[model samples]
Target: MSALRIEGYVIVSADGMLANAKHVMPDSLRFKGDQEFFNAALDRTGLIVHGRHSFEGQPNSPKRKRLILTSKTAALAADPSNPNAVLWNPAGATFDEACDCAGVRSGTVAIIGGPEVFAMFLDRYDTFWLSQAPHVRLPGGQPCLPGVPERSPQAILAAHGLKPGEPQILDASHDVSVTPWRRAG
Candidate 1:
């Protein structure tokens, strides 16, 4: 398999839910800094890969190429709804093929997520930019990653050889912060 530098970006609540129970980003978690950080990070990404659920309700659509990962796509094909988007099934197409379908040649690819999307790239991420709102906790929210009920996000990333850097405050008043988890040298 060819090596691809896939980076990830996510925002979570303290209890480790990427979204609330309704599977939507909570209004309480919205912050300008997190949005800005993600946008700036995307500037370095050549292609984006995200889950179908996350794509359907996106607030900020990407102007660049994207590959929406979905089980619904039996074959790799262009996404009908998006000009610069492709629908990809990893089992049906190689990463390179999917990138080609999305018109991306090479460079960093950003893995934006729902839990399933995040889990798919556990060992693939070169770095994961994790933003958090520590003040908020969604009691019955969706977990950050699936199949890792025994582990915290930190432990799961650590198992995948990712080491988190010191959390940098995104918003002091709201206790929003971001940590970059890099593949350890």
Candidate 2:
């Protein structure tokens, strides 16, 4: 294990969903404040780890040093389209191996999401930046974590030993706020 600081970042609706049933994030969930916050945080990261859907959803993703989680590949393979990315299969290779492939030996590793990708790093996150669009609700939508429909997002984080800090309001007009959930000492 390298001295990697893993962090998770996500925004969810009132019902704790990341996207609609179609696995698409609707307009209601997109807030200027949240986008600004996410972008600023990502800029400070050394590496980005996410799934295919997340990769496609983010802007300027090809320019960043990242590992795209995928089961399609055997373990680790070069991403032909993006010179900065590598395809990683966690089952076939360790996180360290993926980092090596991406040449990210240390520093912060930002885990941006899509359910399965978010869930994979639950126990490993040093901090998880959870933003909320309290006014939005996605029924029968995709969860931010595996236990979401059955449990609240906060509860799941607490269960995984992460405690929520005081929330910072991102957009007061839209009632958007972000909380950093950190591992308990």
Candidate 3:
């Protein structure tokens, strides 16, 4: 069987901007407990799927299989150094097929994102790991899951048949929360 997971590190303001899309990292925003959470997530993931922007944002790494989902013609040429990187266009192959080809299988296939990618696989994902920043602000930026209505994350997850599973508060330093959700039936 195939398994899909949607995971993201998001920081949203009260008004709801996830983070600055233009900047490498958002302005005045810290990762909080992201390092530890991300490390754990990576350990469970067999393959990492991400948008071109998210792929580019990553620092150099030789480990893990990274797939970039894009419709661009010059996709591979854009990142020649990373030979392990593969460009997957949904037009050519569905996300599931690509993950299978990359040996994702029953193991976790983490779909990291830039909104559109999250939207595409929302219905298909069986798990979602969300890093919720309690008190943070990004004045002018894109939302973690744009086009998703102004509702609490719990409400949104419930609507999608995903219920919170394990939640760990990352201390009180950054006021961030890490929660994992599983699809219900």
Cα TM-score per model: 0.91, 0.96, 0.79
State the lDDT of candidate 3 residue by residue for 87-162, as single tens digits.
7778777666666656666677677776777667666667777766667655556766655437655566677787
* Candidates by TM-score, descending order: 2, 1, 3
For model 1, residues 87-109, the per-residue Cα lDDT tens digits are: 99988888778887776776888
Best-fitting candidate, measured by TM-score? Answer: 2
Error of 3 at 41 (Å): 1.3
Residue clash pairs of candidate 1 = none
Compared with the true structure, all predictions reach lDDT values of 0.81, 0.91, 0.63
Instruction: Report the error of model 2 at residue 92, Å.
Output: 0.8
The lDDT ranking, best first, is 2, 1, 3
Worst 10 residues of 2 by lDDT: 55-64
- Give me the overall lDDT of model 1: 0.81
Name the lDDT value of residue 20 in candidate 3: 67
Tens digits of per-residue lDDT for model 2 on 1-185? Answer: 65899999999999999999999988899999899898888888889999988853457555779999999999999989889999999999999999998999889999998889999889999999999999999999999999887999999999999999999999999899999999999
